[model samples]
Target chain A: MSTLNEVLTKNLHGLYYGNRILLPFKADILKAVIEKSIITDFSDFSEQAEYEIKDNRTEIYFYEYADLSEFITTYETIKLIVVEEGRDIFDIKNHIKLILHLNDGHEIKIEEAGENFLFIE
Target chain B: MRKILPVVLLAFLLFGMTNQVNASDFVNPAALSAEIVNSDAEHSLPPVFMVIPFVTLLLLIAVMPLFAHHFWEKHYPKFSIALGTITVLYYLLVMNDTHSLLHTLAEYLSFIALLASLFVASGGILIKVDKKATPMLNVIFLLFGAVIANIIGTTGASMLLIRPFIKINQDRIKPYHIIFFIFLISNIGGALTPIGDPPLFLGFLRGVDFFWVFEHVWYMWLPTIIVVAAVFYFIDSRNNDGQEKSKEYTGQIEFKGYKNVVYLLIILISVFIDPNVISWVPNLYPLPFGIREIIMFSVVYLSYKTADKEILSSNEFDFEPIKEVAYLFIGIFATMIPALQLIAYEANLLGDKLNPGIFYWATGLLSGFLDNAPTYLNFLSAAMGKYGWDVNNAVDVHNFEIEHAVYLQAISVAAVFFGAMTYIGNGPNFMVKSISERAGIKMPSFFAYLIKYSIPILIPIFILVWLAFYYGRV
Candidate 1:
């Protein structure tokens, strides 16, 4: 019954799920991802994460997993795990479900209401 | 109204002088003094031929229903119309009856109107031109304009090509580098020929050989081409880098009908034949009296008929841009008459003491601010007077060491280069800027444009020109 905010605070990682998440890190990362695959050296990212900041919020896919153990691991704090059925993970047709799992095994699901928001499901 | 008053007063002063003078003044000393005063007054009046009809046309165009549509209203609607009306009023009411203000006005207006028609027609053509090919289309249009400047004259090319440039770059959210390209390529690229610019054309008519420009091609052509190409490359790179690749299309682009291309060709050919028409060869071809006119009007008619209606419908072709050009240029051409006359008549009085370098700098500076063509002619004439006339042999170099031809070449080069210094210096500069603005590129303001772009970019080009052409081995 942990809230998404509490899980995000405890894990020190937040999950974003939509079409393409506007990385809070830097724009060159996105550009590098699109142009060249290797995203080495994020030194250009400002303390405020200036490079990735866009005029509007970036969109990323949303997804949910039925069995959280498949995505969670002992050493890693799962920042985001999105699940889709009967389609590729990036496919728009399948409903997207997103979960943020903390090291403590607390989980929060991101859902769509009017806008994208985090919630415990 | 404020601008029109001086012109009216000048007109009245000229009219009073012409009427008050006696015919016997030539025989009698006292009467001759009066005649001299009258002639002075006449000269003081604005060139009525260029003035009156321009003003009248401006007024009519301003009040016309077709001019009040949404397009004009959005961009310079009221100012353009008001300017046009004022121009027409100045010419008709203020100028004296004897001056050729009306005739000159008609000639220039005809020129402007022909350009207006071309702008509208070509804009329509752009809308019909395949959207995917727009970038290639723009490059083609720019190259075409550059080439045509050598053939028809820069003003002619500018008038003919600007609409298409305006239309191709009409999509909002695009960059405005095209305006700078037009100034460099369309305006200055044609520096090598008398036919390429009005000043050079004046030179040809004034006894400079039609091919004299070719003699200095090594000096003029190379610099112009190199500078323009450099500017184009820089701009094209910036535009490409800034824009995102777009894949969305409604799949609605179709040629509809392309027979209008022929009409465009005819208009181009007319530029070559325009001098001939004036020289009367076309008249002697044993066709009807207004046969040339008939042919010209018919071409326009057919083009209008054959243009893809759907494309025109999509672009919402309107007369706003043309109307704006027509109105502004009327004031420009009219007010300019007195200024040009003064320069032409009084250049010798200012002393032929000015060297080619001084003339180059002076003419370039003025041409940068004023219209370059008239500025070129004024200095060209002054150069002629300074070099002296062999009354009998017709070629004289008074005190100058350089050949008269070299001086002429220098002046021509200056005129072309300096005309690129300002938005209003050449016709297409403003049109290209406006089009880019419409496309949503925030172009710099008048002084800001010069300070930010021209000074930094064009100065180096000018220096290269100086070393390579004017001060170089020729």
Candidate 2:
């Protein structure tokens, strides 16, 4: 039962419509998180995307390509994943990692910042 | 000659009957003295500009095109030049210093933005729809307008729907059909709910429940629908029969901008967020700004970004309609301030002595000529003072077991249903008429329109509705 405020504060560059937030993740990873969350009928992805992030001190903007609704649902799912992983869900970095749910999809891992997770794939 | 005789006869009879009633109704000297004192008090006050707006707006609209063409031809060769001069004159002089500038601006902007969005969206639909699908689409479009009117409001639904109605019938040789359309879809169809018409919307704001109107649907809805549908069917059949089968556009229907539909939905949903409804969303925390105000800005942004430029260019979306509506309504909304004040005072005077049937007919009849929304509120406030039927008392009155609620309901129904009786009755009716004329349908003159179109078709249906449903019950 992660609050929207809590998750929103952690994800500085996330997107939302009403209460739903779009996550920052690879298209496939975002799709997996959305399916698990059961928040949307995930469909085609966008070629250009924008992320809206808000925090206590600063707000940042980012650009990426992903399905909008799916991205939002995945962001919500990531908040749940962080709590379920028994991680300190308050940390923004930990929340971002939790969004990248791996195959055998129930489990998720946090790829630390500045790590070469993109290359490893 | 034939038509003139009946109208004259009816006018004489009405005046005669009213004069007799006034003479006899003044028996008690004490009561008469009190009445005279009250009348003197009302008369002593600085006369408020009430009828000026309605009359002026109608005159300006009728004469505007003539002035536009004249000015354009004589001095400013460009249409835009003439339009600009008129717009400036309108804003600076006519609409200046009379009302709250900020309130007027906000209303004008919203009105313009909504009308522009509808024009663009409908233009997109027009480009995509095949010529063959148009007749069916026209009816469907109007029906959609009727539904939306009940949801957003007559003004909202009209601004959003009129463009598409205009676009669908743009190529038609006959245009009076669209005037009838404005009557039914834009005005009459919105009678079912508080959100449907301005009068009902005002009622909801003053204390009526959002759902309280449904109670009268049994009496009002069935009659309104049958009449409107019958009129639409007749007009549509006449137009179809006269139409020549022309191979207009052979292209396949190609909807380039279906995504804009989402923006339309956003606007439709915003109706529920209007300040009145937002106050009812239980357990909702207060937002920094009004929910409806926020939603309005957001939808405008969405529409501005998503609308297809090509479609807009093709339809030649001009500022004229918005400019015209803004200019006319400025006078209307301004002068109406006093008219409404006087109406409120009068309704208070009538108090509980006013019968519901009388309220129904009077309110409806007045609404047909004057703006229905204010007329509705005027009668509603009168009913409330007499019946003790404000929001707090809404539930309490059930225990009284009287027909006071029924009378109130009748007032509500009549205000909404009969508002469509004349062209000037609703804001969009005249706009639709102008748009149709612009598209080349020799629309009838104002009186001609009522006599030939609305009266013959609508009045009979209205009578049938009254006889079958509203007559005996109350």
Candidate 3:
């Protein structure tokens, strides 16, 4: 004959097992998605949100991009320009960080260094 | 006689009452000792069935992001908290002891300290190396990362070098480029020392000599680097299609927030040295937890507070990745207790027969899915238990370590090296991916990464390692 205690212990173990596997992924799913424009909400989250790694900081300047996978209503040619350093972070050079299938057919691109630093096509 | 019998009954009842009153003061020492043993046993081996919270948490991390993105993002934290609460409750109520749960949480403290401090400190660095994107140059950069990964630790080295690697190849990256980078920088490069990977750090904590990895792994280390680097060079050369390296990025290289190096040094020293470094009276006892964390975190805070705003703005540092790791890993650490226990139990069940190669692959394969830190501990325990390595005896450990060098080396190499097999394998893999994606490179999905690179490039290399080192030895 099984006791109530046995049943309860079994059930509690179930809870432990269940929660162990489920909780971690639970809190973190929405934040993981990379939408078409990551800059939309976080554009103003912090000042100079670029995490400094070394002697220089990496800066991004949004340009034109189009996510065909996304609804065309939100699909604009969104481009981002990243400048490595200096107060001229806003400055887009003769080069456009072109994205042609860089986002798996979605973002930075420069064809030919130096001379073709500007897009000829 | 009848009158006397009634009186006697009254007297008997009164005597029984008196005895009952004194009985409260009596305790059977044997019974008391038995109860204590029972209490300790309550926490011993949680039902192996209790792996739900851990497995569910990881599976959700693995599958949910791909399919139910919205729900996962919205309800994940709630679900995690709820599940974590349940697990804690099980330990408290069902197990009837808090020691195991408390011990697990303590490991988490060090675990988070290592990850979080690295997260904070490494985020402070923004490395900018200006090499033309030639195949040879890329190979050199990878080699540099491989060496420094041993020095700064994988997480530190990955954070330090990822951006520069991305920037240099901004124009010419194929899917394979980042894939190879994960292969070499995040995984292979971390094989030489305890500081290089979390698994080795855990081993170091287990009294494996800090230099043991270098002494044993050097042969494995040099060849793997040579082969992987060579393969990367070849693939890069063929893929370049005659595209030339850049010359215009020729300005004298500049660095900002160079002071964070001191902070990183502080963090590393804390990891390496004992907490007795903080003793006021100079007595020779190690504090349970060191001031390394206190000093490390303070440096992270001060770096942010004092650094120029431009430095931060330029770097685009965000908290999302670290937060994700923090939240998910708690579940990982908590739920994985039983799994770790199961491995240990199974090893014990095997009656002390052990194998070096099997341990290597087993640890590696499990590390591919579960966070490698705990998995490393699992197989390490299995190995230790099989050999009956008592931690308190320094002579025993030294003898066992030297005698079982190959087995230890296998576990160490497998845990550190195979972490590149998936995005979730090591601490730095996903974050590196996240950072790269943010910088405008689209890293492949988790499974895509496995099918394309890990299974193809890394699996074979692992097999080669197994064949050469562990084939007959196990």
lDDT top scorer: 3
DockQ of each: 0.01, 0.01, 0.03
Model 1 lDDT per residue over B1-474, tens place: 543454334333323333333332211110011121224446454454544443343343334324442343333434443443444455456643233333234334334534544554454454223343244445556666777778655654664454444434433223334555656555676787766765555454344566777676536666666566666655554554313436454534344335555665665555434322245523322111123334445665666666676444333344434444544555565445545554555555663666656666677776776667667756765666665542112234222213656667777788887778877666666665554443224456566667766677776777776665555333
CA lDDT of B29 in candidate 1? 12
* Residue-level lDDT tens digits of model 2 in B77-180: 12222332333234334433212222222333334344444443443332334455244556666676777778756655665555445544543535555665
CA shift at B43, candidate 2, in angstroms?
13
Identify the candidate with maximal TM-score.
Answer: 3
TM-score of 3: 0.72
Q: How far in Å is the alpha carbon of B59 misplaced in model 2?
A: 4.3
Q: What CA RMSD would candidate 3 show?
A: 19.2
Pairs in steric clash, model 2: A12-A53, A21-A72, A22-A71, A22-A72, A23-A71, B199-B373
**Per-residue accuracy of model 3 over B116-231 as CA lDDT, tens digit each:** 66766666666665556788888888988988999888888887777767767766776678778888888889999988997787666556787999999989988898888888
lDDT of 3 at B378: 62
Candidate 2 has a TM-score of: 0.57
